[model samples]
Target: MLMMFWQLTIDANDPARLARFWGQVLGYQPAPPESDTTWWAHYRGRLGGRDAFDDRIFDPDGRKPPLWFQEVPESKAGKNRLHLDLYPTARDDSLPYDRRVEIVDAKVAELVELGANVRRRERGDSYYFVVMHDPEGNEFCVS
Candidate 1:
């Protein structure tokens, strides 16, 4: 695939709800409408009903690619062929193993409050991570 300026696209049953959850998790903001700064309102107005828009969110600091959530008819099935890994402590290599575990666990708790459910905790020879499912059951990891 062509790579420049690409955004990650997510399929969701309820695109707006999923987008809200991810926006909070990633500290992202919704893309504003061209004619209005009121976010969802303009989209809703244009569509004249619900299912207003395909949700888009961008990293506030402009470091990461934007996320675009599209409405899909089917539910998730089987394991994800690809997933996201979140580093709560910003992937610090100098940190102790136990310290990294603590940081990851703390971040997991925060995520749980935001609608993520932990599947399991995993420990490897050199790393620790938590497998989690989003509110809509998409799998991702915290480390």
Candidate 2:
């Protein structure tokens, strides 16, 4: 049997810019083309301008899935159905709730300075997370 690796593709108004922003947020970097033909050309017949890439980023530590941002002219209109939850403390059970909260807050502040906005914070029995919108208005959480 064979396994196929997958990449999370994101639609973006400014693909390269969004990729850079996410790179800063996740400590990821631009990923090189995986193959000599890293593009798909089928759309060229119907959508001539479509390219295989807008931008792509990958975790240097190889711990997270690669992200590929594709350019789209349409602006985001509704809330995203899928989103990411970032665990700043690496999801360590030993970290106290307060400590995790503090770390999450710090990360939120940093992201804000880099062009993200907080939507709100949520509390649970033993959890705390801040829902935020990325520079391109994609929703995600930090905890």
Candidate 3:
């Protein structure tokens, strides 16, 4: 038998706060027994008997994956060799590249208000993605 994946762990200077941010973004609800310094929250989902953190798991009509935040001391430094890529499920694949960029621009702005910062941008003839840092400077992408 193979072991199952239990969670996706994110390192944060402020685990509680970061967890809350991700919980909202992903629609996860706070797990029970929370205190002034709790580090875990559980989102409801199922994937082969394992819980998967999807997009929404809180609202009565929402559902998504499980996201867990852990505390860390130092701030993220240099570049993240690995990062998450988020794609809009409703995007039109036939849209022009420039138009897609425009759509992502609006999303980037919204994320900025939520404490994400644009780190870098790269474009190619066929594709492009932006590197962004979360409130604690962890890297992620929009493509």
Candidate 4:
């Protein structure tokens, strides 16, 4: 049997807050008819299936799967060995590089207000991206 990609889990000090932030950023809705203690959400897209993402926020106790955000005692330190890179889904070859940079810049400002810190920024002749950290200092990139 072939195994498919399930989800991307994150360890966070504040699971609920981080889950909510990511949900909004990814345009996902909270799992319907929510239950207590297990905060779940999903995003619908064409990549994997109608429900491509199954994210959850759980207490320190370990349970469930598919992007579970469990509470941790120690804080995140140093650089992230793994990170996410996001791109514009609606991008077309028609737009110029400067326009793309402007669009991504606006997104960076919005994410910063949503508890992300800019780590670095770079622009090329045809592309641009920004490295940012989540509220808990986990690194992710926006392109």
lDDT of 3: 0.62
RMSD versus native structure for model 1: 5.1
Flag regions of model 1 displaced more than 4 Å: 1-3, 32-54
lDDT of each: 0.80, 0.79, 0.62, 0.66
Model 3 ranges with Cα > 4 A deviation: 1-3, 31-64, 89-92
Native-referenced Cα lDDT, model 2: 0.79
> C-alpha displacement of 31 in model 4, angstroms?
0.9
The whole-model C-alpha lDDT of candidate 1 against the native structure comes to 0.80
**Weakest lDDT window of 10 consecutive positions for candidate 2:** 37-46
Candidate 1, 1-143: lDDT as tens digits: 74355678998898888888899998887753333334334334655553323477767655577688888899999898888899897899899988999999999999999999999999997889999999989999999
RMSD of 4: 9.0
TM-score each candidate.
0.79, 0.79, 0.67, 0.70
- After superposition on all CA atoms, how large is the RMSD of candidate 3? 8.2
Residue 104, model 4: lDDT of 81
CA-RMSD of model 2: 5.2
Order of models, best lDDT first: 1, 2, 4, 3
lDDT of 4 at 95: 79
Misplaced by over 4 Å in model 2 are 33-54
All candidates in order of TM-score, best leading: 1, 2, 4, 3
- lDDT string, candidate 3, 1-143, tens digits: 74343446666678767766666555566542233211223222222344433322232222333455666678777777766776642356798988888877777787788788999988888677788888888888887
